[model samples]
Target: MANTTDDTTLALDAVKGEHPTDIFSLDGEGDWSPHITESNLPTKIIWSPTMGFSTVDKDVLAICEEAISELEKAGVEVVVNDSIWEVNPVESWMVFWACARARAQQHLIGTEEYESIDPLLRLFIEMGVTMDGASYASAIDACHHYNYQLEEAFQESPLIITPATCGQPPKLEGDGFVNGEETASWVDFTMGINMTRNPAGVIPVGNLDNNLPVAIQIIGQQRADLDVLKAMKAFEEVINFRERAEDF
Candidate 1:
């Protein structure tokens, strides 16, 4: 959103309204100040080479590997592990997402209002309404279990790194490509983390052969937003991938 980490902190403070009891809310005075710098690098990081998905593009994976090497050279312990989550949380997350949408748009159903909206969103709402109560409850239980798993991982390493996207950026009209095949689920990497509600940030690592930017995700422990930002800042300094308007 901003050109630098300090700018991001300032922008967040500007909109993070005053909420006394909310633990996630920013504390007024010192909270707005930027604490991340070159010296604030993480001691250890967990690097998930893949999200256990076969659709990840080879080019994206290569860039992530190179980034890992750079991080290792910078004196940070990088643990390479393929198994991060015991069970895929994407399915469970989808249930919650669809159900939430259905609840919000329930009144529009069976009316002209529903038919007038976008077809893809209409399909999502339809899926939500048809879901049984047991299924929704099951999804909730799954998410809780997954959160526990993430908490365990965070105990071993304060941060986890993964490719921000499975493949090259998807075109506005279509899905992304992996190994020359179009894959609709290429963007599933972030949804599972979203379910955990852990703090995550992305930093550009390199550019693909097509000149499209590729990035890696840095996920931090729950309520560790500052730690995530610090790691991002450190990685940003090490990688030093700069962008120019003409490159796009």
Candidate 2:
């Protein structure tokens, strides 16, 4: 939501508030300081090569590796751990996401409002409404299991790194290219984290051959937003990517 760690904190503080109807909002108060000073940099972090995917584009993988090398040169230990999640949580996450969307928009089904919705979103709503409650419960169970796996990973290393996206930015009106294939599912890297509600940050690591920027995802243990920001700031300093697109 912001260009820098300081800006992120400022934006969050401005909008963070309690609402009687918003049950999901955090209930208690705690320190929000980013603690991004040089002395507070993470000593060790985990890097998942494929980010729980079957394969990632070779160029994107190389960019992540180069970022890891830079962090190592800055005295941070980068541990290679490909098997972050034993059971891939993408399917379960999709089921849960679809069901949530259905719950919110199901009332409009068969109405003119429904016809006005985008076709892809209408498909999602249809998928959600047809899903059985037992399946939804199963998805919830699977998500809990995945959350436990992430908690274990956090115990070993407070932070985990992965490619922010599977490949370069997609065209404005077309699917993304990954591993030489055009696909719409190029964003699976962040699904598990979203399903588990972990705190994640992204920083521009480098630009692709086409001049589009590529970034790495730094995910922290649930509720460890400050630590994630600290790592992002530390790594941001190491990479020092300050170039702006000339057209912008």
- Give Cα-based local distance difference scores for all models: 0.80, 0.80
lDDT of 1 by residue, 123-208 (tens): 88889988998998898788778778777777778888899988788878788877677876677687787877888888888898
Candidate number of the best TM-score: 2
* Cα RMSD, model 2: 2.1
For residues 1-248, what per-residue lDDT tens digits would candidate 2 score against the true structure? 76776677667666665668888887545445545564567899998877554467778879878989999998888888888776657788879878888999999999999999988888888899999989988987887787888788777789989888886678887777787787766676777888778889898888888888888999988888878888888788888888776664
TM-score of 1: 0.89
- TM-score, per-candidate, Cα-based: 0.89, 0.90
Q: What shift in Å separates residue 25 of candidate 1 from its native position after superposition? A: 5.1
Candidate 1's C-alpha runs over 4 A off are: 17-29, 111-113, 246-248
lDDT: worst 10-residue window of model 2: 27-36
Clashes of 1: 0
**Residue 47 of model 2, lDDT score:** 88
